[model samples]
Target: MIIKKTSLVTETKDNMRGGNGAPVITHVIGGEILGNKGRLYSKIVMQPGDSIGYHQHVGEQEIYYFLSGEGMVKDNEETIKIYPGDVMITPDHGYHSIENTGTEELVFMALILNADA
Candidate 1:
């Protein structure tokens, strides 16, 4: 299916689980609310000193791609710096979290699956 800009959609606030978020979430596309199958995903835009909470999955693989700005990722084992166009993957047994480490906004995409994850 194709997404059309002229079509009206819904808007919602994202009550972030941690320190100072952008204060909202827009469902550009995904499941449950958008009828996607099995995958629960979203686009999150964060800024310096803002972040998402630390969490993990039991049986899923997750990835965070740095679209812009700079950040760091801790995977329960080590912490590493993230730069533009960088990617970090978290396996099922590892714990991971990302933080903005730049002077500008950090943009990225988060993907999580509901099944066995």
Candidate 2:
């Protein structure tokens, strides 16, 4: 199945997971398409100073692949700088958060998969 870019769903999340400013989220595919394998597959765009607050994953794992701009990620207990082409993986029971610190918008692809699947 081919999912067109125009058919993707986009929305702005305010203080997402307790972050700072609203971040734009574009859903590349929904859970229905993933079937029991994952819950999220999307593109995230965060303006300067925007963030997705630290949170722990219970039964799922999330992967973030940076596409452009700069940012910082609090991966578990480590605070690391993120740049284009950087990838972060938060496994089940791990904690992580991200913040955009660049002048341009931070763009990334996020995928969350069920740990049991």
Candidate 3:
């Protein structure tokens, strides 16, 4: 089965996960699609000045693949520059956050899955 782009659901949230500005979330799959399981597959768009707050993952892990634009990714206490084609992984028991520091929008694909599943 193929999921068309137009068929995908997109939602904009202000201060997502206690973040800074509103970010657009394009849900590709997961959640109810996974029977309320621990999984997330989505595209995230963060405009200038937008950000996702720092948070820790205990029972899960997340991977972020930058598709376009630039940003600063805060991994624990370190802030690293990120660009297109870059991939970052925050393992279980780790913390991470992202900020759009460029003039253009920061676009990325995020995949989250249960650590033990």
Provide the TM-score for each candidate, comma-separated. 0.73, 0.97, 0.92
Cα lDDT, all candidates: 0.65, 0.96, 0.91
**Residue by residue across 1-117, what tens digits does model 2's lDDT show?**
888888889999999999999999999987999889998999999999999999999999999999999999999999999999999999999999999999999999999999987
**Candidate 2 deviant stretches above 4 angstroms:** none
Winner on lDDT (1 vs 2): 2
How many clashing residue pairs are found in candidate 2?
A: 0
lDDT of 3 by residue, 31-108 (tens): 666554457899999999999999999888889999999999999889999999999999889999999999999999
Among these predictions, the greatest TM-score belongs to 2
Worst 10 residues of 1 by lDDT: 6-15
Find the 10 residues in a row with the least total lDDT in model 3.
30-39
Q: Which residue pairs clash within candidate 1?
A: none
Error of 1 at 63 (Å): 1.4
Strongest candidate by lDDT: 2
Error of 1 at 21 (Å): 3.7
lDDT of 1 by residue, 1-117 (tens): 776755524343343555455423434556654343335455567768776667766666666767788887777868899898888877776677777778998877666644353
Error of 2 at 21 (Å): 0.6
lDDT of 2 at 2: 89
Order of candidates by lDDT, top first? 2, 3, 1
